[model samples]
Target: MPVYKDKNGTWYVMTRCDDWQGQRKQKCKRGFKTKREAQDWECRFLLQQGGDLDMLFKDFYKLYEQDMKARLKQNTWEHKACVIKSKILPYFGEKSMKDIQARDVLTWQNELLRHRDKHGKPYSETYLKNLHNQLSCIFNHAVRYYDLSTNPTAKAGSIGVKNAKEMNFWTKDEYMQFSEVMMDKPISFYAFEMLYWCGIRLGELLALTTADFDFKNRKLRINKSYQRLKGQDVITEPKTKKSNRTIEMPDFLCEEMQEYFSMLYDQKPDERIFPISKSYLHHEMDRGVKATGLKRIRIHDLRHSHVSLLIELSFSAVAIADRVGHESIEITYRYAHLFPSKQAEMANRLGELKKGGGF
Candidate 1:
């Protein structure tokens, strides 16, 4: 039994109890003027208390952590935890699981829209899309187990449906200009070369140990990557099954890598091929680009340039996909420009196959 106040003054109400476990003894402070209002309010409040949204979220995460440990690979859990901490937790960590609304998610998305990276570039549409995707997964799990109102992220919708237009790749002369500027910084310069020629990721490149290179076979093994998990750097397995493939190094680059290896301070087979921090490598890359007067060229674009060159050299899509560790041909299709120009050139030769009429 509880006393409550209203415009007419105070009135008494008593909650019905069945058992100790089912009974809700909490009192409402505000007085409901009508008997129906009071009954509805009590019922809703009791339902909410029974739900215990805070406890539900905490318990859900505990189950998720356990399932992740048992079902997911170490690298997968590490990656999810990293993103959850760095990109997600700081925003929605304390939010009530059931009360979090669509607007709350939209506000967070808007904030991420204006967010910038360490390099001062605004968050890419691609990056935001990925963040939203991860958030959606988390919400989906919550909804499945915790009885949330709904997944707030599901209502946020996509930022955009279309991807940005393709970027301009470098010409042969442009690549030469880039190389000339980077001559003084051999490690950064050659690291770029390796990524371009080998078509492996920067993470994969850094994770390479000396023993992974097969000089006699002219092959480079790529099985691991340096990933940032929970703000700490760690060597982890690649993202997909295809990422474990070995690639043949170009003759010239192979020779250069051999020379680079010989110049290493530690000649141990287990030592990292490039023994520099990511920052130092990126700094050198930026410096070289600046010195070359090509500020628009990104390190990633070097990979694009390499794929473009391979297309010009007439490699098939399957071959290109294999080299680049693309899980599907759909991904390879995004880089299709490499082959089209060559195809057009080859098509021009079709005119030569026709016989010419005599005058």
Candidate 2:
């Protein structure tokens, strides 16, 4: 470790580490305001070079972020990076990975629990859980690759939950009332129509182009998704492997979409049919909800609304899951309550079988 004061009175550090070829190389960092700061940086640098758990938490997180950024979708990775930077970095940035204890994690969690937003509401359980998971993942990476005894987060226990308890959706009749008013705006109307009738995710809906629609076959293809990131509109592959699917569009919906396309002026086959920003859709939703006086639900709830409709029409879980591009188990589990109980029907069928002596 070599700590030196530069000409301008700022401190700097020169450290030595082995490169990939196993040759010793000198690394230099500047701009430390104090001698202690330079010494701390050198210590962390040496520990990191030693490939052990003694590196600073913030330093290890940088490596973890580099690994994840390459692995995740741009939109998904941005959200994860934002959460980790905003919430987890503040408390642990200067702390050492080797010194963090279970009690320290508990204290951080308690502070999070006591925090309130501008709305005076504490963070939602799902949000809290995600934050904790992000923190735990940092330590888990260290345990797997770096020499670490145990994850303090495992001993601290996680806060919040994996999923929210409340689920919301509109009945078919309610959607009818809403769509009735929505017809005044063709774009809004057609968008909601597709969401409710086709059961596609919003991103999938936005990424649609003229080529995706096969009017002759009455089919709509979903192979990509849209995301608005950092003031730029980005198109990426769909959320999951199952998300790339083809759906049979109802004739009425096909007609409505054709009419909507006619409203556009020379839009290219590759151009998005719905070119508006997501905020525009949210604003339209606000107007519709206010005018219809219907209970408010998120745009995503339109997906749930579709699932609920499928259940009511007596579609099996597998059929509904295939249509919605979700795993059958997720459909059966998330909407389990909405699925009708068949205990009585099973008993009656069994009784009929007994009478027929068809064992």
Top-scoring candidate (TM-score): 2
Model 1 C-alpha RMSD to native: 9.6
lDDT by residue (tens digit), candidate 2, 234-328: 99999999999999998998998999999999999999999877788889889999999999998989999999999999999999999899999
lDDT (10s digit) by residue, model 1, range 1-359: 44355567644355643334775454534655666666655654444445446543434455557645767766677667777778877877666567678898899888888877789988766667777877887778767765666888888786632345355567667777877777777787778778767767878888888889888899888888876555676787886788889899878988988878777785777667776666776787677667777756656666777777887787777887788777548446676544556567666666555444322
lDDT of 2: 0.91
Task: Give the poorly placed runs of model 1, Cα more than 4 Å off.
Answer: 1-66, 69-94, 110-122, 145-150, 160-169, 228-233, 337-359
Q: Evaluate all candidate structures by whole-model CA lDDT and list the values in order.
A: 0.70, 0.91
